[model samples]
Target chain A: GEEVAQTPKHLVRGEGQKAKLYCAPIKGHSYVFWYQQVLKNEFKFLISFQNENVFDETGMPKERFSAKCLPNSPCSLEIQATKLEDSAVYFCASSQSTYGYTFGSGTRLTVV
Target chain B: LAKTTQPISMDSYEGQEVNITCSHNNIATNDYITWYQQFPSQGPRFIIQGYKTKVTNEVASLFIPADRKSSTLSLPRVSLSDTAVYYCLVGASTGGFKTIFGAGTRLFVKA
Candidate 1:
């Protein structure tokens, strides 16, 4: 079985501060995806990566949010100048193909 | 992108069968239908997937109609632990490979 690992299960930050979340995809998985779940709502796609290259960032907020998958390093999502609305459970998922996906437990972010 | 619509919620009892249906009228020819289950405070887990006809696994079964416009996920003999939100997704694989989830159906299994 494959598992995606997410760090900082819970995080509390002040508004306007910076928040960073990390995710380690399952070994041998080639595609990584980030999603945001707000207030128990549907998961919203944020960005996706193929290996170290970003394949799609259409769902990401261009100005304040950025994600990267460095060589041999776990993927990271960084949010600058966080707002109250930024509070949500961020999930990371990885898959080798289209049929199945393995997701991390998720990181809950609370901004006040 | 194929848009999916499912019931907002459903109720069932322990030892009973539960079937959740999803509709995707604009599904593409190459799109696949996948179902996922999510418990509170956790990520969605894959239940089953199907391209057409019927596919069954240990956890659940997926029945896709001939037109591919709709599909049903059947959970047999559900238990209290089966109470959670179930999401149905329809999408085509890109070079990046992404799956988009709709609002999903919430299943409440009573003991």
Candidate 2:
């Protein structure tokens, strides 16, 4: 497809529950990236994948956050035991070996 | 990764030329400057990118000096629709690298 597609436009979870978000990159793009936007600003890079392999994860929180980009499946970012601070919009972007990235509409995650 | 600095906010009337400048004093040799415009509740949209000198697109223009320490994004005759947060990023264009974003300039275009 032409655009990066994200599922579940919005998700609400209990503080101790789990939350999972999905992203399907553009058909030809080889890389996928996940970002968390807090306060409607401050985009925090979460992780990146180079064709189903983890590329960079330095920005991801160590304990409760995990992600995967598997072949023939959409990429997923999972948060375990979600906390209050976990309430934010999660964005997915796809790119090739170039400078620009095409982003999805994003999934709003709210932890109550 | 290169850090950038920009204004917190700026106000402009409609049909006015708006220029937002960014400073990346530590820009590396392989770095390219890129700009993105983000509206409320939407993802950032790529505007223009340049390594040096000038790059003009149908939407906006980018001007970079020889020093490569600073660059400006010029919007000709901006309308209310142009009001949004503009982000300046400097990084290696190797693609899919973890990008660093700073506090973007909030542009408020009024009528």
Task: Give per-model CA RMSD.
Answer: 1.2, 1.0
User: DockQ of candidates 1 onward, in order?
Assistant: 0.63, 0.72
For model 2, what is the C-alpha lDDT against the true structure?
A: 0.92
lDDT of 1 by residue, A1-112 (tens): 4689999999999999999999999988888999999864677889999999998899999899999998889999999999999999999998886667888999999999
**Winner by DockQ:** 2
In model 1, what are the clashing residue pairs, if there are any? none
Q: Residue B80 in model 2: shift from native, Å?
A: 1.0
Quote model 1's TM-score: 0.97
- Candidate 1, position A53, lDDT: 94
Give the TM-score of candidate 2 (chain A): 0.97
| Candidate 1 segments exceeding 4 Å error | B93-95
User: Which regions of candidate 2 deviate over 4 angstroms?
Assistant: none
> What tier of docking accuracy does candidate 2 attain?
medium
